[model samples]
Target: MLSKRVFSLLCVAGIAVNGIGLFSGVMMIDGALYALIAKNMVLSGNYEFLTLHGFDWLDKPHFPFWCTALSYRIFGIHDFAYKLPAFIFWLIGALYTYLLARRLHGRNVARIAVLVYLSALHLLLCNSAVNAEPYLTGMIVAAIYHFYRTYREGTFSQLLFGALWAALAVMTKGIFVLIIVGSGFIVLWLVRKEWRQFLNYRWYAAVALVLVFILPELYCLYRQFDARPAVEVFGQTHVSGIRFFFWDSQFGRFFNSGPITGHGDPFFYLHTLLWAFLPWSPLLLFAVYFSFGKRRVAMGHPLLWGSFLITFLLFSASQFQLPHYLNALFPLVSIWTAQLLGNMGRLPANGTMHRIQWYSGMVIVILLCALIVLFHGSGWWVFGIITVGVGLAVLVLTRRVSPSNTFLVSYAIGLLIGIFYGGYLYPGLLTYQGGDRMARFINAHIAEEHYPDRLYVLDLEIENFMLGFRCEVPLQAIRSEKQWDAINDGSLLAIRPEALGEIPDRFEVEPVASFGAYRISRLTSKFFYYRTRDAQLGEFRLVRLKKR
Candidate 1:
């Protein structure tokens, strides 16, 4: 086991990396989109409705926006403020992971569980992106922990809090949280044959409390969509927000009948976990195998296995799935992985596990080093050298403290990769995100009194969000010819180069500036190679439109 001082230092290091992400620019696509929605809420002073580019938006639930808007109110609107609430919720996940592990196993496992959660590769990446998953992740684990407590102690307060957290989870995502949370307890009771526990009156009361707590979400959905049936969403009138929340958003996605859909791959998550749980995936595989294969029926905490397996299989079978969807299960996975690592001393295959971790850590470090070299060439030699020196120093120090503790080495390596990604790679990639760059350019020009009227975006969803969150003024969407015709003289317009042909011939469009653009989230080899990067980039033009 790690000493308290060492564990504290590692925890601080993990937190510092997450903080780096907090202050970084909001990412394109999801992050910026979510930021804009929350900013709209603050600006419009209408928390009941979610709007995007002056249209009624009805994709995600309102809980995350509510948290983000509250953060904006407290901290003022900016990237840091937008991401702060999600980061705090992720920390809540870490705390609950520790508490849940401690409850199930002990303090040592709890500490290890916290470390596993903080250093999980995708968790670190998602923290910077600031999506609904972060909020859902924290809430799901918290609800599960409290519900477990209620099961053990039968306290009304615990059950109430569990219901409250579950409600928040539902509000953050959808009704799927109930299945993820409830399945665990049901499995637990069935496995333990504690049939009487299912008959507990508090379970029914918890259901009522969850319903009562979620009324705010229901009311908001009702007023926004149900009451305003004339408003079009998903290109149709009479779209019900409440129905979407309970059915279309969750089950529709599962069955591929929602507005948003994806092709199902049975093994998508199975392959995704190999990287998503990086520097720890090998250990996790071993842990799961040992936990189930050797001690299946004897496993004390069936909640972890039940929740993870049921949710994993459900996501695997779902048509609409994304890698981040698995984040909610990480806390439970962490606890299980931590249990194996915490008992490393007593494990018969301790040497094999140690070697597996060491090799996996080396593989990650090598890949990250290769990426740095590939992206920056020899310019990053100094960085590479310094990283190597730090790695060697960590290995030496850990060896001296506990030669068998490969987890410390792996943890250190994960932190190093996180630092490099969060501090260097992510910010560099943002430069190619034309929307943010254009927004900044527009903000600068506005300060200089160039094209002083309010700017408009050409109805590009992702670009509009990227520019909307950063641009100082509200952006009107030019969705139709009428809206384009309504642009005031000397007002600037942000448009994609390919869409430039759509401008009326009567207007003289003079380009103010052009920005190189790429979807930083969807990277390709052509984009990564400096020699070919320009070819891969599209362009966004800031132009002044004048009537001919």
Candidate 2:
């Protein structure tokens, strides 16, 4: 049997392995979108509102872009530079998760919570993707932890830190941050029936601090939209940025009254949780069920129950929802799951723990086999071997490890899978994201003395910011034949095959290159099946329109 120190060291090693692909894969659309915005922020010296495609952008707040812009300044524009800040925030979140879990449930449960938070499949996926979620997740958790510390210890410093963290979260995503961070205090007060907690002068002070910290965000918004100067937005003019930030962005979407709408079936999150929390989903579900087996069990941690349920129900009610929106609540999930696992270990050796371990082991093994089969032909033979080795290690450890440590073993398996995918498989898959490839070709051509005076994007449907950033040229949207008249001898045009309805006899152009292309995020089962069988989705062509 391994010593406790040996087991602990293995767990740490597993986490490091999971982090191996922290910045390997090429940036996807959302990631590239932020990267381009930050690149522009540094280049154009505009640090206020986010901008995309040379337009006023309002889909998200400025903190994430600001951080990325700062990272760009420090590291000089690269994929790692764009992602470094968010990854640091993600680490901060994990640290706070550990500290908060320890404060509530002691050291053992805290360790489990940290492992749960880090090894979460979606969290690992987002770490590489470099989205707002990483920043929000970190800040939200930090805020919650500090707030909870204030509630328990009545530390004024904790309250101040909590308010500051909360402000950062709000700055990152907007008003929705309140719903997530405040829900814990509201739920705790209600559960304990502590009316004084609400009336506490510190609560008011915390709010004031939050407002002060968010002044920069407000100032930026005011300069961008509230100047009373009309700006076109969402196909309309004179749109109010502050109104969108406060009302339309958060509540309007929640109540289905926003300009941006989606098919919110009320149960979208229920199904999404299954895949988003993979390898650990079964355990999480069991923890939920286990908690409900006793009366007033949830009342113990009003913070967790309040944050999880409020965020869950709010998203369920929203007209527009994405799975990552649920990320803010995952820290609570990790804490709850950790406590549940820790409690299970204290009880007499039972069928329940063994059953969970057995089933989880089987799931991991099956997933490994599936991944091996899926990528077998990709010539990632090294990853396949590593997968097999990890699978074998998991199988052996399931029987050899103590029941108390089974959860850690399961987490290691998930992390192993994450390492393989994030480090090896995903990067290999990104080669099919053809816009970046085509952009490189164009960029190389432009580097050779022939600088294109103008660039045209003829495919309205394919809006790849990565392509624009890579081309290092201003992209002009070609809307009509009248726009075609502006093309000159030094003009470059990129068009999707389907977008070109007919070839004009009068137009003289020469093809530079053509690529089989599709969005990496849009890769589906059919795409993989066809790809393994050597098929193409569509063609993207780059041409030079001759000067007439």
Candidate 3:
């Protein structure tokens, strides 16, 4: 029999192998944004970007500031360097989750939990993309693990650790963690009836932990107000970094109906998770089905309760939504799912219906692999087709011979999807995306020739980050009925067709280039259109619109 150490090493290898594939699917946008922000901060020497991008200041809290900015200082402002820290946090988060599960379940179950979290479709994707989610989640899981230990065993440092981790999570996002963490604590209290424990000395450590978490915000406030004192954010005339950190950034997003829009679809987030945690989505359903049949795990497993309730309710209740916000909840989903799947072994492992489902999934995966080969559009069509066909054949063989190869089948197909999407669909997609290519077009044709006075966004979001990255210029938001007026002082300007239509003054600029299909994407929904003199505009998809 292998020693415990050797078994541990094998589990690590398996998790890493699966994680690498998941991270590969982590598309560029979020990671790219974090990288860009860190680069700008280091290059411009402006650490207050928490307020930058036109003073929705304090709209986002500062853990990201600490994480990315620290990476910039150490790694010197490169995309890969910025993404490295997030990757590390992703690993750490999975590790902490394993420990937590180990404490409650067992070593075997914990190892399975880590593998599940690392292999989970959405969670793995988020790990690849640099966002505050993983960092915050890492800390949150660590805290949850310790907090439970502290409560059950009455340990001193464990309670403090829980508080500290919860605080860090707050710094990463906002007080929404209070919702997640609080929900878990309340459920624990109700279940255990630990009324006296609530008022015990353990409570003070929790308070101290929270205070320590927000220490960075405290320093930033004192530094900004005490030193510069002139800069302001979020219509407050003066920037109170602490207030923004605590409320405006965290809770503000919920209340924000500002010029920035918040989507109101109630079912938006739930549906989004189905995609984010792809391939795993169906398995999560199976796990949930199994959980209902076996009702032993309770809310004291805050990892399960907090993640589920807060994510489900917060996004559903929120006025604004994005798919990534649900990312934190996925680790919990994977943990519970792993627990559920592990338990399934005691019962009947398989039957005709189960085998049929597996066969159906294999068919779907094979078809997708075929489509990927077809769509890649390379002259090596014969080679690509043969390669993927062989791959599908291998998968089919594994499915038949190794019926326990559920994750292998899911992973093989998922990788094919992301590869085809990124390598093929992405480049051709710029015509509709108004993102990477728009700025490239400008840099190639516009920026060098005209010597525009300054860049402006012209009441539009397209070409914003692209121009910033490509031309290294921050596009000022056009603030008035005179949109693009800032750049219109007889100097050259770049304007989207609609923003150009808003100008009342005489502006005669010939069409230097018709960037045909500059921002058309297949995902474009809720189409918009506008007409302008220099550019012909028609209905366009909203998916191509700019976002932070």
Best by lDDT: 1
lDDT for model 1: 0.86
Which scores greater on lDDT, model 2 or model 3?
2
The TM-score measured for candidate 2 stands at 0.92
Across 230-330, the per-residue lDDT of candidate 3 in tens digits comes to 76443345656666556655566677644244766888877887777765676666666555565564112544754576558777877778776776666
Q: Which ten residues in a row have the lowest lDDT in candidate 2?
A: 291-300
Please give the range of 10 consecutive residues that has the lowest summed lDDT in model 1.
395-404
- Give the lowest summed-lDDT range of ten residues in model 3: 539-548
TM-score of each: 0.96, 0.92, 0.77
Candidate with maximal TM-score: 1
Candidate 3 stretches greater than 4 Å from native: 1-36, 49-56, 127-129, 218-244, 252-266, 295-303, 352-357, 370-387, 390-395, 398-403, 411-435, 438-454, 480-492, 503-548
lDDT of 2 by residue, 1-548 (tens): 23458547855775576556566645667877777778878877989867665567777888888898898899887777877888888888888888888887778777877777878878877876668998999899899888888888899999999999999998898888888898978988997899999889888888899989999988888889888458766777777888888889888887878787777878899988887886677667767776566523222267887889888988888788888887777888888877767666444443566666666766776676676567553556676777778777766766644545567566766687677667766776667666677778766777684767556775334436667656676666654587666566557778776655554555666777887776767667666653453464677788766654
Ranking by lDDT: 1, 2, 3
Error of 1 at 95 (Å): 0.9
